[model samples]
Target: MGDWFQTIVDVQATPQEAETLAADVRSWLISSGIVSAEPTHCVLGADVGHPPGPRAETAVDPSGWSVPWHDGLAITVGRTVFDAGQGDPMAVTCPHCSTTTHLADERFELKYEVWEPFREVVRGWDEGDDIVIACPACTQPVEPTSWRWTDDYFVLAYLGFTFWNWPPLRPQFVDDLARHLADHRTVLLEGKL
Candidate 1:
């Protein structure tokens, strides 16, 4: 019978430092009379997207694994091996697209937190606009769907989200979470939509 809240903080820190910051924030919440919060259970490494840009790595054989670059290029796994008499660089399969084009890493890591809002008159809120939703699978824009309570907890959903990852911290993810919570709040708590 109360509104729920989820916050996502994206940071570039070591896992230990990140955990410390999360714990500190949680403690601060409790001290400030915010609802009790918990850190996400795990960290996930995933590729966000790759836009067309200047080439960063030479295309080489796909025999080895590819690595990501921040500028949207993936470095070939190994140095280019030229044929006995040719100068054309070898081609590799793009991991994200599977095309015969050169492949790159373009991957990043993210963390998620699930906070439970357990009381009436949820307070200390901010408006969310200019939110961006990107598909975890395709990295395309997605619409927010709904949120549901599950296993005595709340989870957010998007077009491609699963129970494995819920309550995405971005505005788009939050919108999806809000929709999920509204749709299944009754079912989650009462067994019916």
Candidate 2:
């Protein structure tokens, strides 16, 4: 399991609009000092180009969706793109009952397939479809919110900012990003592998 967190902004724009939005996001990253045009003080001490290296799904240490759909328009911090399950992934507490459900526990193994749905459903979800996943602990139909139990197993989008091992995204950042992309739909995805 990997501790994966991504801030995905669904671009319903045409190709040109997408490019424009990407540029704006890049400018925001540079101006806000979140990232630098030139390598400043980062873990690797070098300007790691877009999409960096070593894909995350290869069952390797620190791999992710590093495809360079837009060359200079991706945000990846730290040497590792994402941390492995941040230790114990899928350990969620039922909001309705407050009962913690360990998804990885042998007892709840039944919900494994249910949680990880088909890739296309995930894509629809990323596009703003409301998907409810049941909690093994209380059997509550929970919707995805931050690190909640309905957290997406996969998301398909053209633009995403992945924070490796970072805590649930700060509200200010979410608000700011939402403000910037007012016309497009934005979804915060918490990934665990």
Candidate 3:
């Protein structure tokens, strides 16, 4: 089976503040006994990451499995594009008129004509270009980051915390983490890779 991961992305963290916020959040996690202070090669797609600490169970839902199957937390800092690691997003909902534009057809095939525009803009966004796409429905300019993707399939952020193969994290735990993130808006993106 493929490895599963859940990433909590700080959507509002600016590029300049990302490193500091990542360090602060990492410290909080370590102090809370959610992860170890030392980094190890326990995470996927990274050279090192903090492993589960003594009180790791405190971060997960009590009703769910508490034993971790794989690795631990990997904090990514910088301009990056994070997704479900599966495929293209099925659709995107514009924040302007609450209009959802479908990127896939009835047969679950990606509609390149519709997805191409988003793809180009997302690429530019990842490259540190401030780009906005006009809503196909409302004809209003909208930042790609403000648009919600299906299943949180796209997260363009400066900072992200990836937890690999851990049990379902408690909602309270996520909230606490967000508080440590200077109360910035966060998004959870989960999928198997």
Candidate 4:
């Protein structure tokens, strides 16, 4: 199985905007010294995978995915996540009983207050939305604001960036990125490998 621990942040923007944002992020990485000078560039095309470097694999594969980016230490920007795998939702705290349990945990039974949002983006999340889950311990409804739905990544619509082997991005980073892109509607998505 592919074993990439990806941290993806989806930006809400158009294709043109996404391209611009990607370039800006690349420059930021270089200027911030997170990436060294003379980093290489590569086009991710075919072979159903993006190899870890500038050279593209010529082997024929059917994943039908392609994009371009600077190798390593920079975020990969794209319109769609493309072949993103699902993971368990971030752990949630039961507000009714103050019991903490993962959303995917069997011990915590979830009752979707509004199932539509969860259905539309089963593997996606946004911080602005209210948490719609019940507490497992007390079997009572919990205030959405009292629960925390934290995770490694979140998937937003319109645009996205993939960070490989990087530190978890802070809230300020997302806010700043959206500010730079002029797209405040962003979300995080965790893609399982």
Candidate 5:
């Protein structure tokens, strides 16, 4: 199910906030009996504008309530973030569709790399399955119900084979390589630690 995890990924929001939300969700999952118990581990992989800070603060209402309203199957194909020693494309044009998307200059200084393997495994997506993504980075024409933009990353929820893209949070995506990750922390209150 590598493709499943890769495709079901999300991004945006302060890393601390995202991690807290993930933890809350995990708690809910355990309390609801959907999972075994207080998740020993909860992982939330996301695309962010920067690497997570050592001491990022979380908000009071960090839990994202929008999930119930949207499908989780979404993908964001941002311009590849390359390393300092590499030559990254100034702009990328989708070979299959000839659609082009631009990248900002800061992304050049940032060490960005196309983690397709991570995307593939986390979202469980493989090629040739009608993977609907955005035009250049993640150009997949999907219903609004399928995807959306949260803070900075694209939040998507897919049903079976259908794919979706989330709307941008406020300002349009600032750059191509801007991505972040939120790792989950588990706490046991009842059973299954």
Candidate 6:
């Protein structure tokens, strides 16, 4: 079986505030015994991350397994494009008009004509550009990040916390974390690699 990961992304944090927020969150997590204070090579892509602490169980659902399986918390602080690891988003829904744009056809073939603009915007967003796309139906310009994706597939943000192979987190735990984040909006993305 492949590895699984769950990421909690701060959708509202600015690039300049990400590092500070990350530091604060790390401190809180450590003091709360959710993760260890010392960093180690416990994450997939990152060189080091905070391993699960003694009270790691407090963060996950009571019914789920509590064992520390693979890795730990990896905080990314920069303009980044966070997506589901393996598959592409099938469609995007415009926030303004509630219009849906399909990126793939009935046979799962990519619709290049519809997807090219979004692809470019995603690239620009990753590179720190404030790119916006015009909705085909509404003809209104909107931030790509504001559009809803299939299965909540993508998020453009400056801060994200990726937990590798951890149990499903508790909703209360996520809410508490968001509170520590100055009430910023967060998105939970889960995928397998």
lDDT of each: 0.24, 0.45, 0.89, 0.44, 0.27, 0.88
Misplaced by over 4 Å in model 3 are 62-68
Top model by lDDT, which number? 3
Which of candidates 1 and 2 is the stronger one according to TM-score? 2
Q: Who is ahead in TM-score, 3 or 4?
A: 3
| lDDT tens digits by residue: candidate 1, 83-134 | 1121212222222433332212224211111121211101111122223333
TM-score of 4: 0.42
Residue-by-residue lDDT tens digits, candidate 5, 3-92: 112122333333335444444544443344323342121222333212112211111122453432122222233322111122333443
Comparing 2 and 3 on lDDT, the stronger one: 3
| lDDT string, candidate 4, 54-165, tens digits | 2212111214334332334334544333334555444555546767655443654443543333333423323334345455667776543234344522333445554443
* Sequence-dependent TM-score of model 1: 0.19
TM-score of 6: 0.93
Per-model root-mean-square deviation over C-alphas: 23.8, 11.1, 1.6, 10.5, 17.8, 1.7
Q: Per the 3 Å backbone cut-off, how many clashing residue pairs does candidate 5 have?
A: 46
Q: What TM-score would you give candidate 2 relative to the actual structure?
A: 0.44
* Model 3 lowest lDDT segment of ten: 61-70
TM-score of each: 0.19, 0.44, 0.94, 0.42, 0.23, 0.93
Weakest ten-residue segment in model 6 by summed lDDT: 61-70
Question: Taking the tens digit of each residue's C-alpha lDDT, what string does model 2 give over 1-193?
Answer: 3334444544343334555666676666566654455532222213543332222222122234353222222453211112223333455555577766554656534355534542223444555564566665666676543223334332334455544443345556666666666457666665554
Model 6 deviation from the true structure expressed as Cα RMSD, one decimal place: 1.7
Lowest lDDT 10-residue stretch of candidate 1: 73-82
Q: Which stretches of candidate 4 lie over 4 Å from their true place?
A: 1-8, 40-71, 82-158, 190-192
lDDT of 6 by residue, 1-193 (tens): 7778889999999878999999999999999999999999998889999999999889986475655475799999998888889877799889899999999999888899999998888889877787897998999998967888887788888999998889898889999989888999999999989
